[model samples]
Target: MTFSAVSPDEIAQPKPELRIGFLLMNHFTLMQVAGLVESLRFAADESFSSRQIFCQWEWMTCDNQPVTASCGLPVSPTAPLDFNQHWDYLVLAGGLLEETRNPPAWLLDAVREIHARNIPIITLCSGAFIVGNAGLLDGKRCAIHFTTRDEFRQRFPKAIPVIDKTYIKDGGIISCPGGTAIDLAADLIRKHCGEMRAEKGLQYLLVDNGKSRSTKKATGEAATLLYDNPAVRKVIDFMRHHLDSPLPLSEVAEFSALTVRQLNQLFIKNTGYTAAVYWRRMRLEHARKLMSDTDSSIHAIATTCGFSDASHLVDWFRKQYGETPGSFRKRRRDVEKLVKP
Candidate 1:
């Protein structure tokens, strides 16, 4: 079961094709699975055809049984688990009530065997909990949905939990919070296939904005709340790009091509927040991400997030999160240290 580290030359010339195996948990999220599979499907061919020239995938289970999604959609497995076959990656598509459900004993043993063989493992959504339960996530930083952060911390104290990130790669494991599987798929495509193919796949999916992982989730959630209005969508996109130098209310209104009064009415009618209030919230979200993801100084983060100064950022952060930025970062760092061997 010994495996050599991948050389730089090998990475520079990745294999022309990849085999992917997906293990679906009961009541999995359909969107998460579809997002990842569709990205791979589109990247498998040149433009419109569904040929498997570069990537291949198979839905799998322990006993080749059909699995139902959280939305009550059923999908039949295409194959049973085959350990001897060469698989570039194996992903677990996790379910809704993951805290209550344990993966079957056979499946847990299969994952451990796969890990021993040097095959990379990916955990989407609460599937991370399964791997943590298997002792695979010990001494590794993993991604979990913010809603599950507290439960994950309580359950797997040996695994470092990272919030606000779409996906993280620690050693041979790739972990992501639920609902951002497309980003993870695109990253894999870029790494193995090429930049052109990955960009084309994203463009085909109409996600060309190139947002960071944390910001992408926020924007997606905001779009859902705004009811997909074209004007509001454009305004939000503009605001995201200008976080370090936010526009004034008048300019934002002008940019959206709506009168100031109309903009205010639209914001309140749709999101129950005025344009100014929404803008401030977006800034705060960005600041929180910076504080968690980077080691920038408080002053640097405040300036980057358009706060007046470090004190202003601290004041707003305390009001929103009930803690100063330094305290929050220190707490997270302490938790991370606990995961180290």
Candidate 2:
């Protein structure tokens, strides 16, 4: 029998790791949708080539109808809703309290049918109320914004609203606050693809994300973010920018207009870590990225990441990652070599 040979490059076909369907609600938040879609888009491609190889995302509606957003931008659906079509997750991104109230009866039925099919659903911002209205969020913990908590409670008494967390996944329903969809997308990419691919998107988006959700040790409860707290975000940004020159917590606290104790409390409450601890972790994350992407020596990388010296970085690196920087770099490079043609 005669057969034609297939090159390795050809064998590396485009098999997407995730198939996500976005179901937009009327008067949805355009910023949230755009951030989420762009995050997945970047993760789907290689080096921002914009190909949907790693991840596949589509905008779908009940009858291929166009949905208008709160920002006055209308998006035409790419396909009609098909329950039989397999999807990794279905995202529902709706707008404020007024927009979410009195949602179309069909939309409610659609979520009920989606729940019946055992498909996971992701709710963004006020989208929580939509699922709550359909009785899907009953007896389940969900994340919602503070503004709508009172009404959501009165509307759906059984559904417990959690406002502090950026996102929470109780069983099949994952709910996130407004504008945190990008973080959710990055996390999904990390789950199906890998950390590096997720980081690629975050890095390009200029997301500081020193303690990315995917890398953190899972607590029984949901993880947190700095989106709602400007003070903490400012401090985190300060730490990221001055990675090569470590600063005192008191100095950072002064810049944030909060006392040392107050700053530490904010950091602990938001990030699950004290300011000093979070700063150290952030430095370690930077060191790891440098080890993976650069050819700098240990001393140079240590100094660049604000470590006292090579020994100091190695000590913390081994403590956190359970491997020396040299060992980690070697393994990563070995994998890359194997994947090359």
Candidate 1, residues 96-143, lDDT tens digits: the string is 855325766767787888887667788888888788877787766788
* Regions of model 2 farther than 4 Å from truth: 1-13, 209-341
Error of 2 at 58 (Å): 0.8
TM-score of each: 0.57, 0.59
**Prediction RMSDs, each to the true structure:** 17.1, 12.3
Per-residue accuracy of model 2 over 1-341 as CA lDDT, tens digit each = 11122234532243355788887777777777787778877776666556566677778755678877787777777667776667888888778567678778888897888877657788888888889888887667788888888988899999878887657765468888775467777777766666888888888888877655433333221233323356766787788788888777788889889899999887765454678888898888778777767899999999999999999999999987678888877666654543444
Local error of candidate 2 at residue 275 (angstroms):
38
Whole-structure CA lDDT of model 1:
0.72
Worst 10 contiguous positions by lDDT, candidate 2? 1-10
Q: Between which residue pairs do clashes occur in model 2?
A: none
